[model samples]
Target: MNTPHTAAPVARLAAATAAIAHQKRWFARMREEVAAGAPLALVNADAPQEILRAMGIPYVVNQWWASVVSAKRMGPAALDSVAARGYPDDSLQYDAIGLGSMDLPAADVPWGGLPRPDFVIAECGADATRKVFDLWAEHPGTEFFPFERSSATTAPDNWWEIVPREWERAYAEDRLDLMTSENWQLVDFLTERTGRSFDIDRLAEVMALVNEQAEWNRRTRDLLAATRPTPVSVNDSIPAVMIPQWHRGSVWGRDAARALFQEVEQAVRDSRAVCPGERVRLMWIGRGLWFDLGLYQRFQEKYGAVFVWSMYLAIAADGYARYGDDPMRALAARFTGFTDQLYTPPLSSQWYVKEARSHGVDAVVHLVADDVPGSAFTTEALEIAGIPVLEINADNADSRGGAAAALEAAIGDFLERRVLG
Candidate 1:
């Protein structure tokens, strides 16, 4: 039996989740068109999606698909699919889970399984990312296209402040040049393969829509941060913000973002609280806890601690905005070292501390994955800034590494000892 709190994900979140269902169904229908020689691309989240939107190519983001697999509790089976292929299931589980799950029986697959991608597009974010996509291309129908990820040469202390407006100065010109050139090459590559002409005007329109959507997200994040008693839960905000994020540059995505902001603003007006007796406010610094979302609400009734923040919503606010004349260059600026600002040492640490203080977070639960770049610095920075942080070492996608009971107990002990103490 699903309670209202559990069954009904907040309204905005419900809309986003429903939109994903609609997208999957639409993908199912689109398969007929794909069979008739329409192109479908499997894209990594960091890749430029605006070009695909403008070119009328349908794309499925790899990370989003992996989250779907994790949430459906098929991660073990998904990893097993990888192990069976002689690949180490433990390595890059977050990025590789969807690839592994591709071989699952139709009934066993989540969301009817992903369609065979005509193109597998990714940036060389890690040593294994391109290789993983290369494996995907080994299937008869798929081909791979990769963009270069430049080394992190610049380390700005307060990235959240500068990235939204002064991004050109924040990142080096050469880095932007490389990404912009690569984006054009991507456009050329897609054009030659799909027989689709790249339209600059259409791309400009997509860029504008992306900016509009991101602005709405910034407003929503500000509204949530300022509102006392937190008008919505992170569990709800995650899907509400993320679904639109994955579909950015579409009109529906822009409307969804605006709708989320309005809904959250309305909730603030109503004094609605997910935890009415809310006491300790927490910040979650890591990926979404897909295996057990209920963990967020677990302490609410017992200790009045409601998780008020997560990187999904916060990064959606700060990470997506870019402004300039050339849409392609601006788009390049958006993704060039995009992940670095979130996970690199000085940039990541500074942003976390700033967010914690601004959100009035009492403590932080930092899930430190081995693959994540600067977990130690993020935690240390928070503690140095007079915030209590409880660091847990585990993969966010694989819950089997640490039992949920143990994880929950550790959190309870942290709250009792460090936070509420």
Candidate 2:
């Protein structure tokens, strides 16, 4: 928690970061809803949130809950729960962390404990996500639903351009068709169980709101990319952009996006510098540094370095937009290969290189998760594009006991010997 320089707390943070507390209250309300006999879902990050949103079912994202567990430093105890259940604690730490915590005592659980899920939905990714959710479904009242995650067949050089309008060309037709059909099955399954009919009109409305939120995020990202000395920190941007993202396809999420855009624009107008001594503009790749977010600002005084970018905000701008008459088809197009664009071969490489250039990042710090594919290609692409990369191999959530100290030392070494020197 030690920072080199304690800059004056900026007003930008106050306006942009309502999601921190809002999410807690949101989770608590969801628990209440589930306890009162309402059907609740536990879904993967890539699972279709819009479907649940439109159905009026309360749900909690598995990864969001994993983050809460990791942030509270209860990751070890949670993993112990996994180990007690005869599962290997090391494998799929990010996806399984929440499952392990599910059996913990209420006093030990994060966010007042996650209510048991009625529906557990996830895509088959990394050879582990579906299995993790399958285990969750083994609980008495939960039902498991899974879809396939296809590899990237098309590598559009700049995904931000075509994905919004021409996504059919950006991704293969088979992928979208398969996902759309699966969504139909999912809709049928939910209808048979919950007795609530799926409404296409409502889904279309959700898609529209999601697009609006993405547009505002696009504005905020572009503003950050164009600004000198960096108007806002990635630490701040992560919550501002991602909290709304987790609750996407709602009026509140879209409004949050607009609020974030306006807040960043005002910071630019005021010529705010997160680190006034800013010299190195850094780009953080992979999942968030949830263990120690203050790590983003650690080298500010000594190295004049500031982390200006993280995928949480940038992907929001370019990743979530789809426009079409059929809401199911559109939603399928939105998530069919969403993770592929960031973690697959040519698509992942091309997009990261594009982002590094657009952000004018002086250096890159790539956190390579054990279960995620394609970190080597991403690093190679950035280096080939002439941007220096420091690969930190660790789980952003589990921390592996000493991962925080290791990351801190490695980044300091990277900045001194490679970047600043």
Which one is best on TM-score? 2
Clashes of 1: 0
Worst 10-residue lDDT window, candidate 1:
1-10
lDDT score, residue 212, model 2? 100
Per-model TM-score on C-alpha atoms: 0.94, 0.96
Off by over 4 Å in 2: 1-12
Worst 10-residue lDDT window for candidate 2 reads 1-10
Residue 355 in candidate 2, Cα distance off native in Å: 0.9
lDDT of all predictions: 0.84, 0.86
Tens digits of lDDT, candidate 2, 65-146 = 8888988888888889999999888888889998999888999887789888899999888667767888998888999999
Kindly provide the TM-score of model 1 when superposed on the true structure, using C-alpha atoms: 0.94
* lDDT, candidate 1, 1-421, per-residue tens: 0112222223434555666676677668777778787899989988998899999998888888888888899988998999999988887788888898888998998767877889989998888787788899999988899999887788877887787678888898999999999999999999999999888989888988888998998898888888667768887888888888888998988998898888877776666677667789999999887878878889988898989999988888888888778889989989996888788888888888888988889999998776788888899999999999999987777767565777799999999999888
Clashes of 2: 0
